[model samples]
Target: MKKSSMKNRLRPLLLTAVSLTVAVAVSACGPADEGAVSAKPTAAGVEPSTGRPTTPQTSPSSSASSRTTASRSPTSARTTSTSTPTPKQAIVKNTAAPRTRAAWPRVTFARLTFEIPPGWTLTTYGSDACVQPVHRAGLPTMFDCAGIAIKSGSIAGNELRSYEARQPGGWYAATDVQPCPVRPTLADGSFNGITSGTSSPPVESGLRPVGSRKAAYDRWTAACTSGYRFSPQAWHLPVSRVLFLDYTGHAETARVLESVRFPG
Candidate 1:
């Protein structure tokens, strides 16, 4: 009887201990099962519950913020830029008015045209043309005419008859046959009928434009007796068979030359 009672009491204590162990095991496994169910594999191959790769799940607002940052990245911003580049401008030529005196009269020689001061006379002797100030006497003979003259066509009996003639030939070429002053001395346009023993070298010698054509230009100074002086400027266009001369040595000479042009 004593042995039976001892066995029965030990059995109850053992059963109670086993029941506690089973309950503790069930509690521990309960959490694991819940976690496994919640961490089911997602379409992106990431565990949503535990986040095994540690990639934080982005909320709606956070996802939008990320997208906005990507749009403003340097590469993306450059591609989306709408600013336009300025175009280069073209070079333009100067179109200012011609340098000339106002209210001056216009004169035409062959195709060449230019301006002259008022009261200047224009006369033609055969094929030669002459221009002189109104203060001068009657027009001089073809050979003796003072002031500006243009010799063209057959210059009768002069070595300058040949339009193609070059220097040293009297009345026949682009250069002066005699050196003269660049300005005149006599108010009446008269000089002592004698030339001084000295003549100056050409003051300017080159190709100059007259109207639309280029002419050989020559200017020189000539000294006459009684302290008188005369400057002779010449413009010869061989192609047009025209020769222009200025002997007045007046200040308007340069202005007149500058005013030269061609009529269409």
Candidate 2:
């Protein structure tokens, strides 16, 4: 009976030992299985049996496309530089002035041709002709010819006297030379005594430069019935039958009269 009890105790210890050895064997095998799993190829186009990584082959078109995409990406992200411009200025210049024009054309009456300046108009009365300034609206009508006056019509007393004073050539000696029907003689014996004396006669009375030759001229005062006073200063040439008379004593009239001449 003691021998049987000893065998039972040894059997229990043997069973415990066998179980511990099995647990140690399983833990040791777990690391080796994990290493095998890691060694297997996982990348595309790789052989799992060989366990070696494969080099993927590329097409020419795919390589070109990848290069183009990389180039275009940098263009979209990059920035370009800009610059500013300046403006210009303006300029100016200079020039000259204008000129003055001359007077009107020459005029002729009977054998007398002369320049009447720019400001006079000519009119005809029957066979007689005369010129008057534009400013003179109403004035005595002066005639150019004494015979033309008698043939055409009788001249006014004021106009007749003016005509006589202007005609130093003694061209006209009509019986109707008297200005007034009954007039006062301006030159009495006393004035004649002063004039006849060799004391230098009036400078304007004898020959002086006029038109194209020596001309006779004199100053005289007339009494008008209208109560207005006037001194008809005049220059006359007997040889050329030309006369310039200014009864109103206007400076412009004198200028025009001085400019009168026979045109070539």
In the range 1-264, model 2's lDDT, one tens digit per residue, is: 999999998998999999999999988886557778666555446554455554554567887898899998766666322233345565554455556656666775645555555666665655455466566434443233211111122322232333443333222223333232112223442211111111112224545565556656655544333233444455655445445545435545544454555545
Clashes per candidate (backbone, < 3 Å): 9, 0
Best by lDDT: 1
Please list the residue runs of candidate 2 whose C-alpha ends up more than 4 Å from where it truly belongs after superposition. Answer: 1-101, 126-128, 134-208, 225-227
Per-residue C-alpha lDDT of model 1 across residues 75-192, encoded as one tens digit per residue:
6667667454657798897899789836888877666677877988777666767777767654322245556777766542123334333343223233333323323335677644
Off by over 4 Å in 1: 1-101, 137-146, 155-166, 169-191, 196-203
Say which candidate scores most in TM-score.
1
**TM-scores, in order shown?**
0.45, 0.36
Considering only N, C-alpha and C atoms within 3 Å, which residue pairs clash in candidate 2? none
- In candidate 1 the C-alpha lDDT for residue 85 amounts to 60
